[model samples]
Target chain A: MAKSHEETADPSIYVPSQDEDMLKKQKKKEWKETLVGYAIISPWLLGFFLLILGPILASLYLSFTDYDLLSTPNWVGFDNYINILTSDPRFVQSLTVTLIFVFISTPLKLIFALGLAMLFNTGRKATGFFTTIYYIPSIIGGSVAIAVVWRQLFGRNGAINDILNSLGLSGLNWIGNPDTALSVLIILIVWQFGSPMIIFLAGLRQIPGELYEAASVDGANKVQTFIKITLPMLTPVIFFNLIMQTIGGFMIFTQAYLITQGGPMDSTLFYALYLYEMAFEYLRMGYASALAWILLVIIALITIIIFKTSSKWVFYESEGGR
Target chain B: MKKQNSKISDVIYYTFVAAFGFVMIYPILWMIMSSLKPEVEIFGNAASLVPGEFRWDNFSRGWEGFGGIGFDVYFRNSIIVTTLVVLGTVASASIVAYGFARINFKFKALLFGCLMATVMLPVQITLIPQYILFHNFGWVNTFYPLIVPAFLGGQPFFIFLLIQFIRGIPRELDEAATIDGCNKFGIFYKIILPLLKPALVTVVIFSFMWTWDDFLAPLIYLNNAGLHTVTLGLRNFMDADAGTNWGALLAMSSLSLLPQFILFAFFQKYLVEGIATTGIK
Candidate 1:
């Protein structure tokens, strides 16, 4: 049956006249369309090759060598990576600080976002106004100006300490104390919970009303319904937010650069900020390239781990009755 | 009983929201008020929302800026870079998205997968090499490193966003245009571009906001004081040993936030919708 279908489908083999001409013309048109498609997307295609692909490969190559900004790279295989892993105290400190920030701030941010989303999802009046108000921080969160304000707000004699003093409680220097310095940064991260909250709100909107109605009919309380219906359905969105927020947490630069400068004992020394210092400040371009690659690997590993575990919890409406 | 319970719940909900809202908004309010406060009065009256005396000197002083460069120069530079970035992002992303969404081509799926992978790849991975590449091209210290990438569809997020939006548009419209003697470009220009207004607005707002608020890119690229952006200008206000001019800093910070505040206040629907659609679907 396949052979017969192939024989009939090949029009040029039997219909050697107008039919063949038409087929050729049709094929030509498709080719022309494809060319036009490529033409339309040429900018991105060119960018992908030169800007993204070339740089990625170049960075990988540079990671294997020692190149300062002043001189050509001297080939030194695996030394940078080895030093980073075994000897560099600052690298270890930065890695630890970043991991702590990511682990602490991401979950806290997600929880705050989820909570706010749930609160707003309760059919309140003027939700639009509330969401907008909540979202404002996220808009200006990464600016140098905000970082400066954050510094002042947590400074020794700043607004936070002033409030503490008025309340009859002694205030420590929030930004100055090593123990609380990282916490100030984390607070900044958690404060910009708008994006994830909006995503959660969108996810909540997608939950079928019938599920809630059915849960209520079955005598399930609000908490029970949330756990059984809402949480399960929202898992996919939660997973997405988790991955994005985690990646963002790793690449955090501006806040630390502006607010802390990886000081107060390098408590808030983010990986990206350290990388910037290496490349720009220390002029260790090759070492920074290696650091960048390590960051990439770390992010990729985390993303893979999340995706690998997602099948267990992420619910898809299309995969119902499973 | 149910009505009374709901009323009680509503009151609690509003109170909770109001309290949290105050916390969220207080910092900004404080910043604005501090900007207006007298220099000595700023730290002295930190706990008070009301300024002891409104001082307009901070604004003038801040606007004068550090060194010879002023806020006007930084603002102009920001506007120039941001405008070009927004324009380039929209044009390139739309064109690229149209190709992905509407056209059938070889390696399309593979290319799209690569784009998605790149989205997850942290910018740090390519930062050094791109910097070096730009350095080699003598593009560093100029806006080329920042602005040219936008023209080349450097942002995967915006492209993905536009693709999602274009996919939502009906293919039947394209087919109708095709029948009316419109080529693919014509179909795009006449049909898709008009319908892509909302997504385009979202892209414009986002690109503008991100570029305006971006510190890292400008920090790395613009080494010249005259070419500094507003973010960089604000950063120069800090002197580690001498202490910051809090009044001037707050004043400039308030000014820095004004454009974003205005944009968000007016086009909030687009902003929320953008985040919702981009993230969820």
Candidate 2:
């Protein structure tokens, strides 16, 4: 490679009239390098257009039309959207259930994660082992097998109910009851708090020790330091975890699908599960596309709202203040 | 007095940690023990941690899965899909990351921004149209739907991760390579690729775990029992209408977790580091 470059850069072979030729060659080389760059990135660029960009635009168009899989799409304009807002009872219920799942599970999971993180942050000897143990749930939490296990665990004669029975209480069919089905799913969601716990642990580590030392010296108690120092310092990480967990909470399908199948009264009919049913099972592809768009809009709106409000509470130690 | 107070706190802290650790790992322990018990003994020994008898036949029975298919076939299918996905993800993501990290091409910032935006875009948004597209291409019920998009850089998260990693590499090395008459590809091949082992390992481990555990994509595409991944096969075992074989199901479930458990044991440092870095970014 070095020899070839030296041969190309040889000065003795060049004359004053060949300067334009050399300049042209340089321009060509530059263009060739640019093309090479594009060539290298073309896989992602092609996927972006075909899979992401094209699908997004197609979904937008499909949202306006009434296209089932077999038949040609008939243009229905905003009728699907309007009906979803006005008359579709299942849609309304799914939206409510999804919102409730997101609202309930996100905060609870965060709190559980934050609590564990704080406890572990005290520098225990077995912290590594404990962290690994906690993280196992989040790894397999979304698997079908785990969901099946969770189903059995909350079944009529399952382990949880067995424990309940042994404690001088009657066992309730937790997964079978419409009222408790969603709660059971929420418990599963909260149980997988290991990811956020890790993030919060990292955040806790980032908090300067001098702040705590100074607070202790000034006679502040643990609660005061937590509220006034640790919490404020960790707000950015909390904000990140909140957004990610909320988005994940909204898109939850497998657990609902595997455990309840949107069960006893459609009590656990999550948004993504409903969309899957509409598209694949019902073959209402167009309406499902519309539902997909609505989910996107809801996520976007929630994200925007969070970002808009983040300035109030999300402190950055580097920025000093917003 | 301070040391005495701290000692008491330490005792309380360890106790709390131990209790919570037990709660965290109880389900896994229960699953393992239940898998060893007889079908009737599962519910009977539900509240107990130990099995009365070690019925090892649960593994063999579960290995002989429902409807002429077996757990061996499912595991084979999963391995095939996951291996291809890991290869495709690492190759495509590294090249894409090199482009964004090293090259100053036209529309670079805009394209990078779009890539970032897609990371936040829910998979549900793209589900239907992609499904239709694949259906039109006669790729339904095949591994094509699961594997091809990966080769085309479908996962923006991995690309972005590699971009961060490649960006951290020194620009001086590229300039030096360029002065030595090495082309852009040469610079990448000679320098950046060799230096990207850590991030590439992170990507490989994540891609393996995600692909192994993925349920929805296979559920959507692979309708045939023969092509079913492990997740789909496990779901078939829990057919809501049919009476579930709890022993076999739990046995297979435990088996499904073995690969992940082993991977975690070996690569715990990289896994935790990957998650931490991703979160901070």
Candidate 3:
């Protein structure tokens, strides 16, 4: 732009060589733009290389070796992976716990989220206040404070039992029982339905009113309307919520780490919790790196699988229909 | 008859809403009320919202933190880390977003794709390597590891959030600024940043809350009780195997949530907006 202004301001007879000079100037300007672009994004460029990419590759390499924090990493060449796949009982245990947690909690959480979201999305007045109140848990749900309170509420002499006794019913040590321990965590996850609920609300709002109106015009009942128009339209949001929650569920650490300490017989040992213990608590950095890589693959595979299958279920409007 | 039916439905809806809302916030209210309860009644009167007698001693006791350090130290560490993180996230995210949204460079599409991909890259993937890097940097036991990456690029979500915003700031404004001799950087602060207020505030709120809530980093890096953030400090305050003062522990736990509660009270609009827009986090 400055070059154009300069050219207009010159208002002089152009020499033949001026064509080459103008082209050169244009090329220089393009080069300058590139330089400025890189300069502006230099921080991210530095961070991506140093923090994310470097660490990911280094972690992958470390997964192949056995290195405690003290000693140099000893390359064991697939031994760690072999043990994780073939032999490690805790690895199997953690994976089983994580898979169960993800599969159970995700659908239940989404169902609550979708059900509540549909209820909130009604054009009825004054629902915003209730929505806000309902959303409070998801905001602070992951905090250590809430996890602390959650532990107390289910403890032997805690509030849950306190209420149970007053109701003339017996109460078990909910946190200490292996059978109920994972269920307690699942309850905690489901309780914070605020996030996916809000996302569902947004998705619900995006749906065209005419779709429902058209269904009503066809004399469709409430259930028919919901199944015919609403469900398909809401599939995309459900898919997004599903992937996000599944990933989050797999990475659940603090609650298990703090509330259950990954036990009553390792019943609530989430994968991330186990990885943390391996690396930091047990100082098995290399083995933990292997665990981390396995987690990375698991998440990647899950995300990819969901995406691959999404075409069959996810109703994208731009694609015009399933 | 129709009016009566509608009226009955309205009553039912409100009743359901009130009951569910109460149940949703019950745990939080219980914690807050229990924080003020005397030790005997804290457990004894577990289901009661009203303590037998209000006790302020719990706060003072909790404030006298573990290892002779106080809650003030934890709060100070959290405040320092959160403030720096929020600032760094906003600044770096906005600048990087402007570059992607407004400029063209070699590998621009590829780089933009990289940014999008990193959003799904779990922090655990980098956990060990990052720890090793910081350890080699002599940054262990310091705030450097916790604080530095934030200054570098922060979250990819922040960058993505701001990129959407910058793209919406009509290109005419940038051209106008250019004609007035504003360079790219000049156009950024002068023409773009002020317009980016709401989006930047969103980044600020999210980063502040996330960094404040972050436990694993501080738990791993800052083992020294003196250097622990509130989240880390409170986690240690009540050791699972050891008997903890439940009164003091609940008191501090409730107190630790104050900043986020305050932020929520003030800026829930931005928080909700950010979440609804992204839907990933």
Top candidate by TM-score:
3
Query: What is the C-alpha lDDT profile of model 2 across A79-150, one tens digit per residue?
Result: 889987788999999999999999999999999999999988887687888888888888778778788788
**What is the full ranking by DockQ, best candidate first?**
3, 1, 2
Ranking by TM-score: 3, 1, 2
Worst 10 residues of 3 chain B by lDDT: B238-247
Q: What tens digits encode model 1's per-residue C-alpha lDDT throughout B18-71?
A: 899999988888889999998777788786789988899989988988777789
How does model 2 score on DockQ? 0.61
Worst 10 residues of 1 chain A by lDDT: A2-11
Name the candidate that leads on DockQ.
Answer: 3
**Model 1's CAPRI class?**
medium
lDDT of 1: 0.88
Residue B253 C-alpha lDDT in model 2: 90
Model 1 misplaced stretches (Cα beyond 4 Å): A1-16, B240-244
Q: Which model scores highest in lDDT?
A: 3
Candidate 3 structure, TM-score to reference: 0.96
lDDT per model vs. reference: 0.88, 0.89, 0.89
Pairs that collide, model 2:
none
> What pairs collide in candidate 3?
none
- lDDT (10s digit) by residue, model 3, range A1-322: 7568556754476554676578778878899999999999999999999999899989989999998878899999999899899999999999999999999999999999899898888778999888889888998889999998988898888888899999999988999999999998998999999988989898899998998888888999999998988899999999989998988987899889989999999999889999999999998988999999999899999999999999999998998898
